[model samples]
Target: MTKDVIQTIKDRASVRAYKPKEVPEETLEKILEAAHLAPSAGNIQPWEFFVVKNQAKIEKLTEIAYGQEWMTQAPVVVVICTNPDLSAAKYGQRGEELYALQDTSAAIENMLLAAEGYDLGSCWVGAFDEQQVKEVLELPAELVPLAFVTIGYPEGDKEEVRPQKELDEVTTIIN
Candidate 1:
């Protein structure tokens, strides 16, 4: 089924509860593809996407996420990592500190939107102990895990999200 972009964005919301069903390989690939297509500074994509399906590892990650039990139930978790040194390769300090993070964040949003389009449920998890996550994921020193997108089929209906702030309150026209 074709998806409407605006509707997808409007429908996007954090999905915490999930069914036991696993995400199909093709669907996961499409979600990753959307993330891969996200914009990067100077076209230097300094991000790495790690797909974690092992239950033991997911449990460890849940512990790192402050024992959020819901995380452990998801069928898969896609960790969005960033390589600062890769950004530093061309843009130096600013790139390392800022651009790399920005690039990965964009990719994370793409993953969420893509999941919504596929009628899959997802949640972007950002709160986690860095060192612990690295240990569990066996990440190298330079690769930083910025966020996680937990994916699975929704177990039930999502609650109505609070209305967003008015556009004027959050935006400004300089001209």
Candidate 2:
């Protein structure tokens, strides 16, 4: 059955385990396309993505993430980065301090939802040593590592749904 956007969003969960099979390049491209289309402040588009598929590198990343073994389960890990200078040039201090992070986050979310739409499992991993990650990836000085989104076929059935707060409980209406 085909799922709508809302259903796709609802289906997304932080998948920690995955099958051993590799993700196809075409599928990965589609997910990246969604990220590329994400909106950014002043259209500066300060985000960059690194698709890491090498087993050795993935292992290194797992170590960089403080031995988060689940990171290695996914066949692909996309590293989302922010080019602070690019955003700063366009939106000034606010862009450097906030907009760059915001833009990269939005891009990551787009990729996550797109992965869900493709019937894939993914997890957003933010806890990592930035300096180590930069060294591992050999990132330039201008690019700041933000997060890693691991993508792969899940090991089992759909992810277990966690409870969420009701809209009324979390929302505030000023009108």
Candidate 3:
């Protein structure tokens, strides 16, 4: 049963390399909109994105990401962050930490799906130095970085999709 959404999801791959071409403004805007529309806890939607297209800035982020060179090649890197303070007024520190992180993750996924829909490649990068990234992006103190997404047109054929585990290997049926 092939469907547009399913096909997009299946086609999505974690692209580790990219061509040296800029993504158009309209396409970037649509991808950002997808991130904005993602659902959040209690509809609070605490995600904030820093769209970095400047080559120098991307290079710096790539350094901060500990030699993830592909980050620098991509046309744009969307840094998805969260403001815990937005959640703090209602819940405590735990709520601020957990919910804000969750909110940002959801937003990143939306952006990824949107990129896939546009036949663009994207990779959700979760490993990075929070403090260094904040310094690189000049983010506010209250905002916690969740993930960095590198997006652009594919440079070449994507690496093959890893084989999925069989249902018997991972799934369980509760009778």
Candidate 4:
């Protein structure tokens, strides 16, 4: 049975280990579609995604990520880039400094939840050498590398429970 959105969000976890199996093309497409549908500031939608599947490139990316070897285990790694110029053209400094990153973050979150709904494992990877990633991907200067999300069938059981703050501890609702 297909899981509901709330359940999917609740079940999502950062998976560092993955099996040798590859994610199906259709499933990957669905995840991408979810990201595409994410809300963006001023509808600029400045995010771009590079789906990395080639083993050689993945290995190079692992190096760029400062030897985060676990990332290479996933069959796919999505590099999220932001076109700051696009947002800047629309909203000036605020757009370039913050909105672009915020928009891309929303897209990444959508992809994470979609991966969980598909019964796939994923982890958001933000630590990496941006210049190296741009060079490896041959991206234009305007496209700034922001993050990476690795996806695959998990190698073992779900991640062990991690502590989280209660909603009241993290939120303040205004009357």
Question: For each candidate, C-alpha RMSD in Å?
Answer: 1.0, 1.3, 2.4, 0.9
Mind giving the per-residue lDDT tens digits that candidate 2 earns over 1-175?
4369999998889899999999999889999999989999998899999999999999999999999998888899999999999989988999999999998899999999999999998999999999999998999999999999999998877666888889999899998
Which ranges in model 1 have alpha carbons more than 4 Å from their true place? none
What is candidate 3's CA lDDT for residue 45? 85
Candidate 1 vs candidate 2: the lDDT winner is 1
Clashes of each: 0, 0, 0, 0
In terms of TM-score, how similar is model 2 to the real structure?
A: 0.96
* Poorest 10 consecutive residues by lDDT, candidate 4: 1-10
Q: Is candidate 1 or candidate 3 better by lDDT?
A: 1
Considering only N, C-alpha and C atoms within 3 Å, which residue pairs clash in candidate 3? none
After best superposition, candidate 4 residue 27: deviation in angstroms? 0.9
**lDDT tens readout by residue for model 1, 79-167:** 98999999999899999999999999999999999999999889999999988888887899999999989999988889679678999
Model 1 TM-score is: 0.97
Candidate 3's residue-wise lDDT over 45-164, tens digit each?
Answer: 898989999999989888888889878889999999899888777677866878877887888988998998988899999888999998877889998888999999888898888888
Which has the better lDDT: candidate 1, or candidate 4? 4
Q: What lDDT, from 0 to 1, does candidate 2 have?
A: 0.92
What is the per-residue lDDT of model 4 for residues 72-109, given as tens digits with 9 covering 90 to 100?
89899999999999999999999999999999999999
